[model samples]
Target: MNAEREIRGSYWLETAPGGAPAPPPAGDVSVDVAVVGGGIAGLSTAWELARRGREVAVLEADRIAAGVTGHTTAKLTVLHTLVYDHLRRTRGREGARLYADSQSAALRRAAEVVADLGIDCDWEEAVAHTYAEAPEHVEALRAEAEAAREAGLPAEFVTGTELPYPVAGAVRVTGQAQFHPVKYLRALTDDLKRHGGTVYEGTRVTGLTEGEPCVLETDTGVSVQAREVVVATHYPIFDRALLFTRLSPRRELVVAGPIDADRAPRDMYITTEQNTRSVRSAPHADGTRLLVVTGEHFTPGAPGAADVEERFARLTAWAQSRFPGLTPTHRWATQDNDSTDSVPLVGRLHPGSRHTYVATGFGGWGLSGGIMAGRLIADLVEGREPEWAGLYDPRRLASVVREGGTFLKNQAHVAKHFVGDRLPSVTSPAPEDLAPGDGAVLRVDGHQCAVHRDDSGQLHAVSARCTHLGCLVAFNRAERAWECPCHGSRFDPDGRILQGPAVRPLEPREITSH
Candidate 1:
């Protein structure tokens, strides 16, 4: 097998128990709510709605948490990076407070669920810290702590001493939590099903017809007629409302391995570095703790893996350099969407809408945001208005215009890839250039196609063009898949759809065996 294709499987998958993957939905069914995508948001929605006496059905293209939820760092904290100070500056103090309040509420909801279910998922309450390495950034941390305090967050500024490394200053929030995300969500699925909420894995939702009883069309030719529908898929399947145009996709890496538990800091920390390092600890089944580190977020499909790989290699080296005695274990990647503004998009798909809903653009804080979104969506489905709904309204373009420069810049970046990727380029390497388990953009039958050589010296080729918006797809070496830059649609080397706003699989190009 090619070293590039070395699978960095999730620690959660190894530790968490799961049942056999359920078969796809086989026949027509109707329910009060049809939730698409079984990640945290959808599952949370199903759990909440089912408890409220609504018959719910969760349709998942893959297993629950198999998407970004399974790949998360799982720091269930409201302190997302250095966001409080910036949110105050950009969206005002009230906006920052609302964001903090929402996340805190979601955290409380998680605690409530844990207590109700009595599930053990290594749930721990720990302090959250944002430390600054340089002297000048100390004020930034101080400002953030103050801002967080004003926003009803229990935050304070201090000289941190837990870290082995030196730090100028830090903003600290106490009572933040962390847990085994996969284990927690898996247990939640059991609770959901036990309560009469049906779950259907391997059911891909292709389209939704807006009618009195919303008709959800699936790839398997089955239809779900529901009074309300939620598009909780990481990237909402259809962008007929131009949701894709408003989102900026961000890809990040998580690396974890064995660590001396006696030495690791109890607090989960994220530094104020340009490319920040998110540090936390995970408990292994063998009673050892794994030092989990995450950072180096970048846009995927930005030309080559050289930049992403270089960033990843640096994180790996840093891990090795910092903890010389510990051996590194896993290096996996995940991507999430962010609205032009940092706030998540959680509301009705359109204004004055009753049946359709969407929850996406969660940025780096999808863990808690997913919970919050589930609450908001559930409120809407139950005809009860949530107070925080106005805060995360998807139709509100005030932030988009306020951050016009950033919003336009992101759109321009996507435009550049959409137009530039299609133009003829002969420099793309030939099919043979790809090693086993490696992929590349090659000219197959005179049309630019994505070609991958499997470890067994077999070839798999698919059209280089993305099925979503016709943008070119780039091979992600870490994940061993083709990722589209424009709208974050992804495909396997054999052209199977992995993620989408594109329901169609990548068009296959006939490849002769090598």
Candidate 2:
């Protein structure tokens, strides 16, 4: 199938996009807030504003939840990969307590929102488990348990209990949760529309400028006038040049399949292996159980899909050995941003841009991070002081020692993309090779340039080398977008910056005839 058909097939066929698309803004529509990106973060932020009687509008590049949120494992837990001990040691007892409280509160808030909205999102409560295979690592688990206790959370250590594989010991964090992301996002989208909010799908935001009324420009020349902008774009849409050095992206995978109800474990578990393994199960509509296992490599620009497939195969094989008749049915992968520091950035975009706000670097914990960010942004917009505000200021210098080195390293990564660059040779586009709404890299005058033919047969060309870092950008078949493997910078097919670490869009390639 063609690229357009492939994307339209997966997104349109498997499931409808999660959030509701708002009507395009007509003329000069004014709003209290304009939210960029229509995923869970954007919808939730818009929802919070609408509840406060603020006029809100959300603009999406494509359908809502078409990004990472729709494809997540949907694990909602305070147990984020042995964080308690790390937080305690790094940030101190108080910092650890605050982090725990924030995540626990986020879980409760999500449940409250579901109940209040009457959202039928298959929400469920489950025990959150973090285990280790090596006996020596049991000490770390115990430390986490002790930290959790000190933080006023219900937590404990378990040894050799409730798993197919024997573990040295595990940390059990009680009352953690999980649910279907799309289902929840759908309800939020509906509520936002009912509350006089607007959503615009297929309307891509290209740029934003600071002014009395901020201007959000779209690809088609449409503009949104708003008092403030909330960039819940997962990655910052502006100041990409600066934030690029501060954040790096990581990839993860998830697989869902059938498991015997009697044999499936009731709790959610993740291992402490370098290439971690996660196991969790939920009830299927047919009363059988569905197990979702995830794990594998965590590196920037790592070849992940195949690695994830292998890990899933290994996990399923392990599961079947422990419980005969288990099999995997669905598989998906996603990319997420990480900061050198553990906490996410949730405040003003920078010191000078007070009107602009951003939320990024969730570090594979968007469940808690998204809710925390939404609440924090809501508080900021309302001019209320959030207790955790100081903890997550985007501009604050990271306290960790090696952070400076990493920041410098990220800058070096970006530098490599531009220094001493050469173009690749152009190849002829066969009559059948180029299709409407399809894109490919071709050699033009011996330089690599991206070529995209719109439905109208107009070809758009841009430098293939991503501006964020030197990593070659790939044409995302599913999203009809350009994605960078090294740092997760994404651009639209027309050379427009979508998500960033790359502040500048790839300059139009000098298309000289070969």
Candidate 3:
């Protein structure tokens, strides 16, 4: 395969096409609970609430499960790449135990749902490994294995056997899983509907009025009144609690293709090495498995970061070299918000919030984290107290001090981009200098403009400023989108919002082609 060939979109979405499109709300709507995203977290929470006899409604800006969840590597496990060891030190033994128990419980709940619904989502039980290639990192792997086992997982240190190359050491955990995420979520959506839960696609909630009954205003001028609201829009579109300060957005590239089942590794694997290489496979046609490899994490649109195309190429090359004769057939990118404390915020939206709640900062391990968020959020909304709720509470302040170094590092990165992007020296190519199918941020009449030249030589110009926080947008040439490095707001070349914390599109700017 040509290394420069543009790869197809997500395999899960391609294989499991969504059902008939659900039209946006025609007018005013009312529900007992309103969920503001359609990914795993939101859909899971809605399904749980609907099962509990709550009148639930899910509002999605795009098709359900077609966003980050669709692009995930789809590993369902309690082992999150040495997280137990880190939590054991920072949050204590009890904290690590709670983390493990919560994640394991979530995984069990997912299994029950799959069995109960009789959903054929290619569910497979397998082992999970956190491996290290460097000899120096072997001790860390041993510590992680011990920590994970102490935290109540079936974990042990071992030298991995499956990969083509040898690893110095690996922390292996059994009883984990991998599956087809889209298929699983689609079935869940159908079940939610069966429980009288309403899902409105293409309905972007732009405004929220907090009161006895929270009022959510959609972009189409429809109002949704609900007693409780859950903002699970990945990055938390409404940031009244200033989550942006604690959460940093990371973008990673994925490359996958079919490999003979006999040749593929049977277990899921991840490593902090090579910027984070996460490996997993799912059932495919003719006794073949789709070998999925993910890595090359970077802050979206961060200045001086490597080019997106180069990143994709590097990831693809790494995958092919690691697994000889493995040809990549599909490639896609996914973004996740990493909380400073490395725990997801899954409860109240903020301290002042009464009827509103939020779930974000899942980092890169959203599959299990999302399921955990769903159960926790439902419990909170129903006025039931779960023992592990405080661990993921958005209001927890003690982590701020323990994890202050990470917090400061992320904030400093964002602060640099926020302030440095405006410097005159940080120039973008002129519109005339751009070739077809290229984009740049150019200064036009004292305004920073995001300009893209299409294959037909037509230039589309929009304001360079991101609507979320006035941060300058950078062009991701491989994806052909303007991405905000600060908060992960993504907009198409034509100025439409793709992903967000930003509810509005980039403003169109008047420009002249030379």
| lDDT per residue as tens, model 3, 243-359 | 889999999999999999998888999999989998888888899989999999988878744398888888989998888888888999999999999999989999998889999
Query: Which is the winner by TM-score between candidate 1 and candidate 2?
Result: 1
- On lDDT, the stronger of 2 and 3 is 3
Number of clashes recorded per candidate? 0, 10, 0
| Residue pairs in candidate 1 whose N, alpha carbon or C atoms collide under 3 angstroms | none
Candidate 2 least-lDDT 10 residues: 4-13
Model 1 TM-score (2 dp): 0.96
User: What is the C-alpha local distance difference test score of candidate 3?
Assistant: 0.91
User: Per-residue CA lDDT of candidate 2, range 1-514, in tens?
Assistant: 5421321111111443433444565555578899997777788888888888889998887677777787677788988888888778777898888888888888989999989988877788899888998988988899989998898889999886688778888888888888878778877888888889888877777788887788988766788889999888787767642665677777665656666677678888888585767788776756677777776535433334324335545655665665667655666566688787777888888877767888888888887788878888888999996777877888777453536676677667655544533434344453246677666777666567777777777777788788755666656543456767667777787788766556567878654321
lDDT of 1 by residue, 296-366 (tens): 87777776542666777878777777667756677777788988877888989876567899999998788
* Candidate 2 whole-model C-alpha lDDT, 0 to 1: 0.74
> What RMSD, rounded to one decimal, does every model reach?
1.7, 5.1, 1.4
If candidate 3 were superposed on the true structure by all CA atoms, what would the RMSD be? 1.4
How does each model score on TM-score? 0.96, 0.83, 0.98
